[model samples]
Target chain A: MIGIVDHGMGNLMSVRNAFEYIGAEAKVCREPGELAGADLLVLPGVGAFGDCMRNLRHRNFVAALDEMVIGSGIPILGICLGMQAMAKRSFEGGEHEGLGWLDADVVRIRPAGREYRVPHIGWNDVTFEGNNPLFADLPADPVFYFVHSYHVQCRNSGDLAATCDYGGTVTAAVRKGNIFGTQFHPEKSQDQGLRILENFVRQGGQC
Target chain B: MLKKRLIPKLQMKKSRFGNRMVLVTTVRFDEVMEIGDPVSQAKIYQAQAADELVFLDLDASVENREPVTDYIRRAAEELFMPLTAGGGVKTLDHFRMLLENGADKVSINTAAVENPELITRAYEAFGAQCVVVAIDYRQDADGREKVWIRGGRTGTGLDPAEWAEKAERLGAGEILLTSIDRDGTREGLDLETTRRVADAVTIPVITSGGCGLACHFSEGFLTGKADAVSAGTYFCFKDENPMQTRSQIRNAGIPIRIQT
Candidate 1:
């Protein structure tokens, strides 16, 4: 069973449903005990970075998640703001500390020039960087839906699994051992997103 | 790089902006008893490759107009896509509550027109990108188009083109313009009205109402000049599924990229 951590951000049901849609037995759990029963864990969010961190801490999920990914070696996936929270720090609403699992920082993607919008909303292609089980079955550059202002910039380029050009090359997906994160919503990405989830489940969620 | 979206609008209710002639009301949400749950509805839409999930609290005003902040919170808790909540939002407090709950975007309709300053205030509070001005329009007696609020139940003296420009100036990041005349009719879009607004503003425009078939989406994009097209009736799960319509549009070379 895959355990989806219920942090108080949006996009919980869709992730759960997507798992169910792919025939994966997934459950939404806020309890750490639930983590022990699951082979894999999924963390999803769709709001501000600061609020997501606070909610994770408030629910006592920070330590539980850390244990699940680092201590217990359980495979984990983070989506959108969930991905941002995995970085070392975020500058969303002032500087806030992140999970520090990956040596990265979440910063706003300002339009360098021209008329690129702030919140890069809509569909964009994801170009694969290296061989990863998470993107199995999908095209190397499939268009996935994205909506966000702040994006994660990995300190070590080796951690990036994929990159999508929004204003420029933005980190779209990252994988470090058993821990993986996607900046876009696979639940909302249609077949490509669904296929990625299916691969994540099939790989038994390993590093 | 932000790729432009091709949205299909779905109306949850009938046209209330006096464009009753061109409208065709269908199985409303309340009437669809078999529909399991709102959260489930969002999940299904997501599974169907819906880029984003938008839920308009259609009955909020008729029953008791409170911000659907709880619904937004609950939906966000379940949905993986960026969620947008509309309907019965009247004040900055409502917008703030919706944001606090989990809405990525707060759509304002009657409230913004009822108190025009609400536009500026919303922009001030949440930044321009977070604000979307949802305008419903129908032609008046003199053949001059007029803007409607309160789910097209109330009409404001402001013209839609003027309102679109004003909204941009007031710091609105996007516009969701629906045509009361073509709503539920499935005939097509209110091309002239939608085009006027889209041409008047520099911000992206999402056209809603009167999407009967796949070609309607094309018309909205090519003729209406909208950045996105949103439809409710055409995309509902009741009788006709939306995936078919989406493919038809894509097959016609509309450049719509699905999840796969």
Candidate 2:
């Protein structure tokens, strides 16, 4: 079973609906026991980074999730802000600790120059860098929906699976063994985004 | 590079005393507007390959009402992509409220032309990234297209080209030009009118009204010189045939959100 972690921060409906749409049995669970029973876990979020982490920790989900996924090595997928929370820390407020699943930090995307739009809101192509089960059948540059101001800066550059150019080279997708993350929204990204989720599901939580 | 956007516009109408009126005018919808829930309809559009979603509260203008807070809040909470809300936007507060509710942008029509000052006010308040000027127009006796105000009933007497230039100068990031003659007709985009206004300004121009076939979208971008094309009927008729239209556009190589 695919369990979507719901802590009242991220968008849970669309994510649940997407998994259900793909003919996969998924449940949005706030309880740690429900999460432990699932074969794969999905951590979905929207809103501020600090608030999401606070909710995860306050609800005792952070520890439970770490025990189930990182401790036992259960396959996990994090989308958008959920992915950001997997990093070491986020600069959204001051210095907020993250899940520390990946050796990365969340930093604001520098505007680079004048007339550069922040919160890069729209479609951008994803270019895969390594062979991964998540991107198995997808094209080299499949369009994905993105709406973010801050981006992930991987502590280990080799862990990066895909990258996209916004104002400059921005991390689009990351994979470190069983832990995976995407800055763009696959639920909102139509076919390309759905295909990515479909590929992830097809892997049977094995990464 | 940005792809040409295809939007499906839904107008918000409310009935007071059982008289259904357009959100922007006192005149009633011919058959009383039955506004489909914006959240559900927007998701339907997203599923049917709509590039973006636009909602205009038609009754807001006639009733001295602002953009419906509950509607905008619900829409912003549910919609996945950038949402553009129109109608009853008269000041910066209205724009801020809509944005705060989850609107990616606000479309201003009569207020920008009538008050004029509201244009820069919204531009400064929300920045050019979130402001879109909606120009409803029709051809005059001299065959020159003229802008319309007050729900496409009252004539503004402003030339389309000049009005577009003024809007761009006022810090509008984009323009939605709807040809009244072609509205609901589905003939094709008014290429000459679209080209004229598109050439008059540097901001992206979204051509509305008269999108019958996939070719119309391609022509709107290539021939009409429009940056985006929007249609309502083609998408709303989901029971009959929706994929046919999407496939045709895709076969034509027009950039749109592909449904897999």
**Reference-based TM-score of each model:** 0.75, 0.64
Angstrom error of the Cα, residue B11, model 1: value is 2.8
For residue B52, model 1's alpha carbon misses the true position, in angstroms, by: 5.2
lDDT, candidate 1, A40-157, per-residue tens: 8898877667777787889888888887789988888898888888999999869999999999999988756434555666788778888998877776458887767788999999
Docking band of candidate 2? incorrect
> Each model's interface RMSD (Å)?
4.6, 6.2
The DockQ assigned to candidate 1 is: 0.24
User: What part of the reference interface contacts, as a 0 to 1 fraction, does candidate 2 reproduce?
Assistant: 0.07
lDDT of 2 by residue, B1-260 (tens): 33556778776676453433322211122233354565677667766666667888765776777667666566544455657888989988888677656566789998988988788877655456577899988888899788988777688889988998998888787888988877766688899989988888766788987776778877888788787787765555454233566566667776554543
Chain B TM-score against the true chain B, each candidate: 0.84, 0.88
**What is the number of residue pairs that collide in model 1?**
23
